[model samples]
Target: MSIVVPVYQGERTLRALIDEILPLTSRTYSPSGRPLVVEEVLLVFDHGPDGSADVIRELVSDHSFVRGVWLSRNFGQHPATLAGMASSGGEWIVTMDEDGQHDPADIGGLLDTALDRQSSVVYAKPTNAAPHGLWRNAASRGSKWLIATAMGADSTVSYQSYRLVLGEVGRSVAAYAGSEAYLDVALGWIAGEVTTSPVELREEHGRRSGYNVRTLLSHFWRMVLSSGTKGLRLVSFIGVAFAILGLVLVLWVLASYLLFDVGTEVQGWASTMVILLFGFGATLFSLGVVAEYVGVNVKTAMGKPPYLIVADPADGPLGRTATRPEPPEHTTPT
Candidate 1:
């Protein structure tokens, strides 16, 4: 197994977190009876305002297992994490924050949960409240609930930063996931065997929390988009419902005017409004069509992959393609 921690303004707490993880480097074992060890601790620096790079360099020099993945710029936590996971080669990859909130000792329990349930991923559910204040915590919960309920990504409704993932699944997500892709949703796209373990989040030992309203909102919107086209479908449903209601109202007004038999003025006004509305709706429809094309172009520009491979092909021979049109001698060359 390996550990991937995304560091951002965490210079003060990085070493302490590593100290806790150092003890479990090779002495532990997973529930499957295999010797579990953190072969590498990847500290991904997202180029924050602190001196985290220097700290990562020092740790890399001190411990052979400690490696640093420095990004070109601040790409936020999820991107940095994806970078770290893409570079990892362990059978199981455990991602946690650089702060001391997540305990490294509890990793064994997560592994146990993964093995017992045959889960490809295991999220560490907080047994206690988060180490933040009320509004921040509330906003976080609200955003998660909205994403799960509104965006239809309930498979990852319980996702948290601290989780255990199969190494191959993690790497696959990193490879194909878009720049703004929500990490949990990308994992859900491939790994269907998901579970959660109870683990209390420890208080940050004097480390500052970098979370705020803006970051929370940004992450929420990304989650909604990366979850699929459920949001678009919801908008379509709402528009269609509203249109049906408007049509019914128009029919009622027309029926009322015709019943009076002396409502010529009102009828003419209604007809004029109807023509104007039709023209406006046609213009808006044209713009909507262009926007749909723009949306597709934007998604392509965002680097969202066309597809992702969760696992190897079934019954494929080792070091060979799955199928060939002709014989194996000259048939399967790509």
Candidate 2:
């Protein structure tokens, strides 16, 4: 097992986090008795304005399992996490933030959730409200609501930092993820089964959140774009609905003279202008969606993978063979 932590400004909190995690490595963490071990704790440094690099160096030198994965520059949280996953050699990988909001004690519950559900991935669902300002919490909920409505997605598609991923799936996603990819969304593409475990989030130990309002909004938009054809489908649906509405309006106009006359006694000019404005707005919105997709695809075409390995990972619960339940060897007569 590996814990891949993406660090932005964690100089003060990392030591405490590591100390908490170290105790677990010496004991059992899996309820299924699957023989799990914490082989590595990878702290990915994203070059923030702090002494994190120096702290990471000290941690690497102090603990045998602790290792530092440094990026050339700041590449944001998901990319830094992917970089760590790409380099990990463990059979399972757990991705969490460095802010200490995610408690280390809950890792055992994550493992149990995955094993009991026979799932490829398990996400942590906080039972209490997130430790953020009221407006920030509201915005987060609003964005999630918008995503679920627009994309026709279920609760499993929610964004979560504390997640346990199958080793092969984690590494494969890290390799093939596009430039603007969201980590959780990328995981959803191939994870055959996913579930969530309820946990309580602890407050950050007197630490300020790294994300400001503008940064959070930008991050949300990137996630929206990374949803992969969902936004485009939404636009398509809107366009179709508008076409149907226009057809109904046209039929109503025709019926006004032929049958029970209504909604067309006034001059047609006002209605015509309203129709024109609606059509133009829809057309421009569709064009904008298309342009956004084109730009993302162009980036994918240009960016090469950062890491490569000789072969696939060992078989786990999400393996092709594992996904299919085995038949009973014998059956009793009914």
Candidate 3:
């Protein structure tokens, strides 16, 4: 099985992550007597301002299994992960954060569950974690809740990136045609025999996280949009609700005009204003959602590489590629 670690500015912890996982490759074994030899650890470096790319290139030269996939530029986490999976040669694929927040030990458990269930994807669910600030926790919960509501509560909540996937299944998902590639949502689409096991989140040291509020919001929006018809269905329901409300108001106005004599200023002006504002708002909101759908299709049709391969050794069979046909256009200036 191969492990893929998508490194984006993970300078402080990347070395440790590699050190911890490399030994597990040889130590972990299945009952079938096949030892887990990590055929390759595809470290996809999305050329960030951090000097991580240079460090990873040196690491790759020193270790045969430590292959560096340098992207021409940043293409966000999901796309970079897909690129790493594309480059790896393992029959099984495992993805984990380069930051030590996700324990490498969980990989063994995830693998065990995958083998036991004969499952396509064995996701490591987060069991416990050190407390984060309230807003951060709330945002995290919101993200998970949205995923659970869309995918299924059983399949989501307490979800972790630490996962083991059958090689063929991973490739099949990677081939899924969508510009907004949210990993969890994408996995939700290909719901093969899937199961989850609980794993404790490691204590995070005082390093700043890569994903801030803006990034999180962007990711959440992509997830909602990529979640498929459930989102559209929700929009449809909302539209119907608004249409009914508008009809009810109109009927009430007609009744007042015909018999009740409720006065034009009170009923006509206020009701008209309320109905006009809400009706127009709802119409625009619905159009925005529709536009999001159209935008994804249009972006996919543009034939761009989802990411770029920046720094693989010349002789090595580099495994990663961008999502669109065109690669990311820049590397970190260094």
Candidate 4:
């Protein structure tokens, strides 16, 4: 098993988290009787304001099994995760936050659940409340529900940082994930077998959350955009409904004019303004949706790599010994 963690400003908690995880590296038989071991722990360092890169360098120098991938700059959590997934060479890839909220001990239970359910991915659903304020928690839950509903996934499928994914599947998704791609949404697209394992949420160690309200909203918007162009389809449906309603209104007006001899005076300026406003509003809304899809397509066509690695573990401390050509730029298409 390979544990993939995206390190932001985790200078304080990352070492401790890795220490807790290192003990679980012992070889053992899984529930299915297959031998299981934590072969490697991959840390993808997104350029945060801290000395996380130094921490990762020190860790990798000390432990052979601990690998480091240094990104050119911060690419947010999901992209950093994709970088780790793409670089990881393991049968199973487990992703967790660097904040120490995810217990390394629960890794066994995640494996068990995945095996039992015959799932390609298993998310660790928190059994207790998350370590956030009430409003934040509510917003988080609401966003998940919205995305799941939009994607037609099970409402009970909770998304969390703590997850276990079949390595092949994770790598496959990572290879194609676009700049706007939400890791969970991309996983949902490819992995038909997804389940949840109940795990108690641990108290955050010392680090503060990387996400604030703005970042959280930005995350949600990206997820919505990446899930699919379902919003465009919805707009089409609304346009059809409005067309039908307009037809009915026209028929009513015609009937009144013919049967009751109602003159043009009955059609007031107020009514005309309302119809014009509705039509203009709907048109702009549909155009906005189209523009978003076009923007995504353009980005994909331009070849935006999810994350760029300045260093790889195989090439020594800072990839100074690398002798291969740089990877081709690529991103998930809209």
Model 2 agreement with the true structure over 199-275: per-residue lDDT tens digits: 89989976899999998987888878988798898789879999999999989878876887455457778889999
Ranking by lDDT: 4, 2, 1, 3
Top-lDDT structure, candidate number: 4
Candidate 3 residue lDDT tens string, 1-334:
7888888767878888888877775766754444576777888887666877777877788788888876767898888888888777788899888778887766667777777777888888777753466788888887777678664545433556788888877777777636576776677567577788778877554466788889988988887787776667777988889878878877876886898766646435676788789889888888888888888878888866666565554344454343557767888887
What are the per-residue Cα lDDT tens digits for candidate 1 across 5-124?
998988899989989999888677754565688899998877789888789888989999998776656788888889889889999999999879999888988998988889999999
Question: In model 1, how large is the Cα lDDT of residue 92?
Answer: 95
List TM-score per model, in order. Answer: 0.79, 0.82, 0.85, 0.85
Q: Which stretches of candidate 2 lie over 4 Å from their true place?
A: 29-35, 252-274, 304-334
Candidate models: Cα lDDT each: 0.81, 0.84, 0.75, 0.87
User: How good is model 3 by TM-score?
Assistant: 0.85
Model 4, runs deviating above 4 Å: 28-35, 251-275, 312-334
RMSD to the native, candidate 2?
A: 17.6
Clashing residue pairs in all predictions, respectively, total 0, 0, 14, 2
Which 10-residue window in model 3 sums to the lowest lDDT? 313-322
Pitting candidate 3 against candidate 4, the one with the higher lDDT is: 4
On a 0 to 1 TM-score scale, where does candidate 2 land against the true structure?
Answer: 0.82
Q: List the residue pairs that clash in candidate 1.
A: none
